[model samples]
Target: MRVFIGYVSLSGNTEKMAVNIKNRMMAVGCEVYMERLDTVEVDTLKDFDLSFIGLYTWDQEELPYEANEFYEELVQADPQGVKVALFGAGDWSQPRPCGAIDIVSNKMKSCGFAVYDRVLKIDQEAPAPDRIRQCEDFADRALSWGSKRKKWRFFIWNRMQNNPKYQRTAYLLRRALDDYPIK
Candidate 1:
């Protein structure tokens, strides 16, 4: 059961949570690979059974510049049969958890990853005690779930190649996503 946590942090709040989550998952018996947002490449996820995404929400729930690049590459690869979780650290703006969760959750869902239940919400106040406990429980559940899920055991076959015209477009889009570095 290999799990990875990919995250982008500025003030270090989201990074702190990623570290804590990795510790918690390790305590619960899972091998966790954590990477800062910039260092991880898209191919790193080829074999991970479960992945967690962390971001620093800015101007609402949007990921900051660097994190956006990481996410774009990930979606470009179109991770097949991988379970994914999305989370972030942001202020208590108008909608709680809506900002990061909304954009990421939808995209991941569209990509066919199994979206898990625990949507963690935290702020400088660190959320309420119950919410913290909820997140802890979520970590335990996710780790256990990840440990048992079966790997796809084969390469992903993108059907888009069946049509040359569409394939060319998709190929160009993927290249664009890769070459476009995050500012």
Candidate 2:
């Protein structure tokens, strides 16, 4: 499996989470690519079977300045059927903790990527052992969900293709399946 991890960390907190996720996925035999979001191209997302974005919520729950361009490009890009998992580190004492995660997750969904439901949100800077474990578990769940989704889509497509009456239904069903977040 191919995986892409894009992250923006001003304080190194989210970077630690991204690294943990990348290492876990790579250990599982996945071809993992990790880069800062500023250097990542939205067009390249289609090449990966799974992707993760790590970002911290800025003041007043805004996305960091570095992520604005990527977010805009993602909004403009066509749907590519890539599955994305979101993770981040933020101060729990803030009024809107990890707000960027919600923003990015919603955008990814609106742009037609299959999003994983289990988002990793760590409190503050340093990632403890438990947070690292959460990152690994998040990676595992994403791989498992992608594997099952692939099989399910293939089976449904093949069955529906053989019957012309169900072709349109199949298309709609596939879209719904892609849009739905995997648990």
Candidate 3:
């Protein structure tokens, strides 16, 4: 199965997580493709079985603008059966929850994607060796979960507009896709 990992990094922490994910997956003999969220184009997706998104939260639980923007684009692109997992950089010093994984999980669930798991990382400065290994293990698990086929989205529009939480999020997402000015 083919897998792709996408990430957005500001202080390079998220990028490191992506690299570790790629390397670990490669070691396991899986075909992997990875790109930064900034370079990833929304139009040409659907080439893989699983897609992973990495980002950090900025304010509250909202995803970064770049990653969030890509997610919005995915909403209007016609649904596909892809398993997605989220990983992101966080810090032990902060009170904010893992920004990248949390937002990705919520958004993907809202949009009807089969989500496997969420990985959250604290900033590494003078790090413990076990922590690094844990990160690598998380990557391995993510790839394994990504290999599975997601639950099919039949009657996708009905599911999107009828689900309680998704109903509201999808409306706003539709507006974003159509360039409706946010009020």
Candidate 4:
């Protein structure tokens, strides 16, 4: 699988999680590409089979400046069947812990991308063994979802292109089926 990981980090917490995710994905024989969100080109998203986004929640549940900028660019682009998985690091005590994950996930869904259901959120300034394991698990789930999505890609894209009603219907169905209790 070809995977793209774009992230923004303040104080290195999110960056650490991004790196761990990159390493874990690479270990599993994926062709992985990693870059800061500020430096990534939104148009290149279509080239990847799977994409991972990492971000830190800013004050009051907002995405950091760079992530917000990327989100704006992302909103204007067609999803083109790229599946996205979100991960982040934040303090659990914060008023909105890892809120950026929700922001990005919602935006990706709105843009008609197949978003992975399980998001990886770490409550630490640095990764612990448990958190590292969580990253690996998240990568595994993402790969699994990507593989399954391949079988339906042509059908979904065809419906999305030829029928406007099917676009929303397909998204809603996928969202319902992918929804699961997060551990």
Q: Note the residue pairs that clash in candidate 1.
A: none
Q: Report the lDDT tens digits of candidate 4 across residue range 3-101.
A: 899999978888888888899988766789999999877777789988998998888788889976778887788788888899998889988788888
Ten-residue region with minimum lDDT total, candidate 3:
148-157
CA RMSD of all predictions: 16.3, 10.6, 16.2, 12.4
TM-score of each: 0.70, 0.78, 0.69, 0.78
What is the C-alpha lDDT profile of model 1 across 129-166, one tens digit per residue?
A: 64456556767776665554233111111334345757
Give the Cα error of residue 59 in candidate 3, in Å. Answer: 3.7
**Model 4 reaches what TM-score against the true structure?**
0.78
Q: Assess candidate 4 and give its lDDT.
A: 0.82
Candidate 3 lDDT over 62-176, as tens digits, reads: 6777776787676666446767777777665657667556656776677777777555555645254654576678877776665543322222444676779798887877777
Query: How does residue 129 of candidate 4 score in lDDT?
Result: 85
- The reply for model 4, stretches above 4 Å from the true place, is 125-127, 148-183
Better of 2 and 3 by TM-score: 2
Best by lDDT: 2
Task: Name the lDDT value of residue 81 in candidate 2.
Answer: 79
Worst 10 contiguous positions by lDDT, candidate 1: 149-158
Off by over 4 Å in 2: 125-127, 148-183
